[model samples]
Target: MPVVDIPGSKSITARALFLAAAADGVTTLRRPLRSDDTEGFAEGLAALGHRVGRTPDAWQVDGCPQGPPAREADVYCRDGATTARFLPTLAAAGHGTYRFDASPQMRRRPMLPLTRALRDLGVDLRHERAEGHHPLTVRAAGVEGGEVVLDAGQSSQYLTALLLLGPLTRKGLRIRVTDLVSVPYVEITIAMMRAFGVEVVRETVLGEDVFAVPPGGYRATSYAVEPDASTASYFFAAAAVTPGGEVTVPGLGEGALQGDLAFVDVLRRMGAEVSVRPDGTTVRGTGSLRGLTVNMRDISDTMPTLAAIAPFASGPVRIEDVANTRVKECDRLDACAENLRRLGADVRTGPDWIEIHPGASAAAGAEIKSYGDHRIVMSFAVAGLRVPGISFDDPGCVRKTFPGFHEAFAAVRAGLPG
Candidate 1:
C-alpha cells in the first residue's frame, strides 16, 4: 500500500481567491494549489490592483473592499478556465474596463451563457474577437443584479461565476438555472461562499434551481483547502486495476467538500473495497473489476479516469449524462473514446455517452495524444499501469493543475507490486 499526499483542491483554491479578493479584509489560504490555474488566478487578481502575497506556509490576499484597483487592464488567463470565467464576474463588480483572453484552446470553449447572464444583470460586456467565446471586454460599473436566468447545461462554471458575485450586487441577486450540469460544483461554490460569511438561498422551482443572494458581500477569513479529489481518482483507479494493490489518498475523507470524492463509490460499484477513515480514504483491489453503467454528471471530472479502467473490467462500461464534457479544455468525450480505441479497446461513442467493452488482450505500444488537456493526460496514464508501453505525446500538459503529476504517478507505480 502506498500513502500518497495529493495537492489542494483547484476548485476550492480558485473560489477562495475570488472570494478573498472581494472580501473587506485580508484572507489567508492554506495549502492552496500552486499550479498554472491557481497562479493565473492570483496574477489576474494582482493585475486588478489587489495585493496578493505568497509565503512558505500560505498565501495572503488583501481584499479590494471598495472595488478593483485598476479601471482598465488586460488579463491573460492562459488555459485556466476557472480564471477565464470567474475573473470576469469579479471585474464586473468593480468600476473598470477589463479584457480577458486565453490560450487558443480556451478561445474555442463556450462563454455566452455567463456573458448573457452578466448582461441580464446590467454589466456591459462584449465579445471582442468572437461572438460567444473568450477575448472579451467588460466595461464595468458594478452589477445591478435584480434577476437573471441562465441555461447552465454546458458548464457549471457559468452558474458559479454569477453565484460568486451574487451578494455583491446592488439590489442583491436572483438566478434561475435550467438544464444544470455538475450540480455538485455549484454546491461547492455555495459552500465556499458560506465559508466566507455569506449564505446563498437556493430552492427548486419547477425542476429548475432559483438562488437568492442578498446584498451583504463576503467577509474575509482564513480557509484551508482539502486535497484535490479529482486528482486522487487516478491513484484510486490504480488500486482498482491492480490485484492486491491499495492506495490511500490522505486528507480527503467523509467531510471533504469536493464532489469528485464520490468517485470512490464508482470504484466500489465496480467491486473495489473502499474505506473512509478520519485521516483519509483508501481503495483496495479485490482482484476483480466489474464494469457498470453509471451517470457521471455530478462527478463528470472522473469520467475519463473510470474510462481508463473500463477495458480491464469483466463487462462493458457505459458512462452517460456527461455531454457537458464535450466542451471542456478539449472535447473530452471524443478524446476518451479515441484514446481508448487507440489502446485497442472495443469502444463506441455517442453525443454524450461512451460504451467500452472489455478487451481480451492488451493493445500494442501506443502514444496517447493528450489534446493539451490535463485530465486527458492523467486519466490515460492510469491505463498505462495495466497496459504496458503506454506513453504520452504531451506529458507536460499536467502542469495545468498538477505540476508534479508524473513524478507522483511514478512514485505510485514504484510502490505497486509486480
Candidate 2:
C-alpha cells in the first residue's frame, strides 16, 4: 500500500485567514496550505494592515473587529479568486480607500455579482476597466448591512464572500440567493463561520434559499486544516486505474469538511474498493474499471480528475451538471476534451458535460496543454500512469495549489506498479 500524505486544504486556509483577520484576538491556523493562492491572500491581508505571522507548519493572524487597520491600501490579488473576491469584501468593512487588482486571468473572471450586491448595500465601488470585473476601487466608509439579493449561478465564491462580510457590518446581512452552484462550498463557509463564533441561519423561504448572518464579528481560535480532498483525488485515481494498486490518504475520513472528498465514491462506483475510516480514506484497484454517468455539480473541482482517467474505463464515462467549470482557471470541460483527444481517446464535450470512450492508449506521447491551470496538469498526471510518455506544457502551474505536486506524485508513482 502506498500512503500519500496530501497537503492542507486551500479553501479552508483562505477562510481561516479571513476569519482570523476579522476576529477579536489572535488566531492560530495549523497545517495551512502554503501556495500562490493562499500566500496571496495573506499578503492581501497584510497590505490592508492586518498582522499575519507565518512558520513552516502554522500561521498566526491578529484579529481586527473594527476592520482593516490601514486607511489606504492597494492589493494585488494574483490568481486566487478567493483573494480577489474575499479581500475586497473584507476591505469594505473598514473606513479606507482600497484599490484591488489581479492578473490577466483573474481579471477575466466574473466579479459582478458580488460587487453589485456590495453596491446595493450602499458601498462606493467603481470598476476601472470592465464593469463587474477586477481593477476596481472601494471607497469604504463601512457597511451597514441589510437584506440583499444575489445570483450565485456562475460561482459560489460570490456567496462565500458576501457571507464572510456579513458579520462585519453594523446591521448584519440577510442574503437571498436567486441561484447557487457548488452548494457544498457554501456549507463549508457557513460551518467555518460558526467555528469563528457566528451562527448563520439558512432557510428556504418561498422556494428560495436565504442566509441570515448576525452582527458581532468572529472570535479568534486555533483551527486545523484538513488534507485537501481534491488533491487526494489524483492519488486515489492512480490507485483505481492501476492493477493491484492501493493508495491511502490520511486526514480525510468520514467527517471531512470538503465536498471534493466525495470523489472517492465516484471511484468506488467505477469498480474500486473504497474504505473510509475515522483516521483516513483508502482506495484499492480491482483491475476492472467500469464506467457510468455521474452528476458532479456539488463536487465539480474533481471533474478533471475523473475526466483524465476516463480513457481507461471499460465503457463510456459521462460527467454532467458542471457548467460552472467553464469559468474556472480555464474552460475545464473543453480543456479535458482537447487533451483526451490528443491522447487518441474518442471524446465529446457539451456546454456542461464531457463523455469519454475507453482504450485511448494508441497515441505514442502527447504534451498536455496546461492552460496555466493546476487541476489540468495534476489530473492528467493520473492519466500518465497507465498511458506511457505523457508530458505537460507547463508542469509548474501546479504552484497555484500544490507547489511540490510533481515530486510528491513521482514518489508515489515509484512505489506503485502500473
* Model 2 alpha-carbon drift over 4 Å, by segment: none
RMSD of each: 1.0, 0.8
lDDT (CA) for every model shown? 0.91, 0.94
**Candidate 1 lDDT by residue in tens digits, 134-205:** 899999998777889999999999999988898788888899988788988999999999998989999999
Q: Model 2 Cα RMSD, Å?
A: 0.8
Query: What TM-score goes with each of the models?
Result: 0.98, 0.99
Give the alpha carbon lDDT tens digit for every residue of 206-316 in model 2: 999999999999999999999999999999999999988999999899888999989999999999999999999999999988999999999999999999999899999
Query: What is the lDDT for 93 in model 1?
Result: 90
